[model samples]
Target: MKRFEGKTVLVTGGAQGIGAAMAKAFAAAGAGVVIGDIGDAAGQAVQAEIAALGGESLYLHLDVSSEADWQAAIGLTLEHRGRLDVLVNNAGLGPAPAPIEQCTVQAWDRIMAVNARGVFLGTRHAIAPMRAGGGGSIVNVSSIAALGLGALMEVAYAASKGAVRTLTKVIAAQYAREGIRCNSVHPGPIDGGMLHGVWSDPTKLERRLSRIPMGRLGRMDEVVAAVMFLASDESSYTTGTELTIDGGAAVQ
Candidate 1:
């Protein structure tokens, strides 16, 4: 499915986890992939893997919270790919669950910087290039916490993701006339290192699984597929919307 043939996609936090999965999937779909992350070794490894799959890719050092890094990433993408067709604001920081009383201001600020502000910077910079190239898609990786459908264990993380959800809608509304589409994905209890603590503890794992109606954690590939759909042309009419990949967790 070479749906992204001739397109170029820039994925922030493409060094590992869901971001890495999305990068590889996009490359397999025929997009020239640009992996933006501070983790040089892992990012380069993902890039190499894409190359091995017979796809074109580039790796760039990016700190999502840094304005300078955002500018450099966007510039590098344009310089290398000549145009940007998709932007996935996937870089995020999830801190250990701490109640509001126990959570420090520094921890809150740090989470907001990466999860919320990072999406802002990426979307802000990607607009011009996309607008110039006849517009593009922006997929913001939010979480079920934004919708008040999670355990609400981390207030700051929930707040940050809520901001992402709102920002995505606003961008979609503001740029629709220009042909730019913005949407968000809300994932719940994905089977990744994000929940290592819960995975290692039997009681915690059982409790977590009990909440999801499907009784299982989501796979990284599931989230990747949702992002791919939102980024692809098949979703031409979709914007300002959110696709939740929570395995019925949100319902229960």
Candidate 2:
């Protein structure tokens, strides 16, 4: 349907997994895409794939935890696309799962820096260009753990994503008057490199699957579909709300 014709969308962590999925979806639906990620090679690969499909795209190096990188990325997007219609903050890191007792200051800081601070910085910098364009949408990729301990062993991840969820509301409420929409997406157990280090063992995988009501893991495209909705005008009336793509697992 070419839902995003003439619109330029910027996606963080666009190199692979959920972020890559969103980039592909937005480009396929006719949005000019800017794939921002630390994964330079993967980002370029995705950009190339998009171009092959006749989609407009560019891959820019973006380290979400760094303000300098954020500024440079925003500048590059403006220079390349002229204007940005949507911003998706999807970059994050999941440290080796550990209980709060074992959570060192470094681990906590790292998680907060990427999962929480990254979103904060992304929205702050995005507001300027978006407001200049008359308005825009901001979508933060949170996690089901933010809804509350969906299971266990995710203390740090939960704390960080929880901050993301609240930060989203703060942005939504503050910028609603400026024609900007801010929302968060909480997806559960998505299979990919991102989920690899955590659920690599059969025991862990089965243990997680047993709790999900749907008895299956989430797909990258599924999460991307939700993200696209929140990123597009289709979610015109939605803001400060979290769209959970957890196959009912968040509820269980």
Candidate 3:
């Protein structure tokens, strides 16, 4: 359904996994896409694949953790395509499991930089360009970890994502009257390589499943769909809300 037809989208972490899927999905729906990732090789490859599918796109190196990078990327997208209709703040990294006491200051800072501060920087740059173009959508990729007890892994990651969740609300409320919509999607235990050791063993899986009524890990495509909805006019009435695309994990 050409929901994003003729729009221009910027997806951070668009090199692979959920971000890659979201980039292709947006392009398929007729939006010109810009893939922003530190992984230059993978980002270019994804852009090539999208082009093969008859989609318009460009690939750029974006370190979301850097404010200057965010500014330059948005500036380039607008300077090249005229505007950015959607901003998907998808770049992030998960730290190893640790209690509050065990989390090194450096480790916590790194996770917060990418997961939380990245969203802030992306949204900051997107608003003005979007305002100039009449308005746009901002979708931040948060984690279901923000909604519950800290799992066996990544305490710092969870905290960082939680910050993103709250940050989304503030932006949404502040921009609602300005025609800018901001939302966050929470994913549960996606089957990406990044999640491998976090839920190690069948027992760990079972414990994880027990909390989710759907009884299975979330797929990257599922997360992409939710992000797409939030990114497009399809969810125009939605703002400041946390949409959990976690297969009922947050329900329990």
* Candidate order (TM-score): 1, 2, 3
What is the lDDT for 19 in model 2? 88
Model 1 regions lying over 4 Å from their true place: none
Ranking of models by lDDT: 1, 2, 3
Error of 2 at 250 (Å): 1.8
Candidate 2, 37: how far from true, in Å? 0.8
Runs in model 2 deviating more than 4 A are: 197-200
- Relative to the true structure, how large is the alpha-carbon lDDT of every model? 0.93, 0.90, 0.88
Provide the TM-score for each candidate, comma-separated.
0.97, 0.96, 0.95
How many backbone clashes does every candidate have? 0, 0, 0
- Ten-residue segment with the worst summed lDDT in candidate 2? 148-157
* Top candidate by lDDT: 1
Q: Specify the poorest-scoring 10-residue window by lDDT in model 3.
A: 147-156
Query: Which residue pairs show backbone clashes in model 2?
Result: none
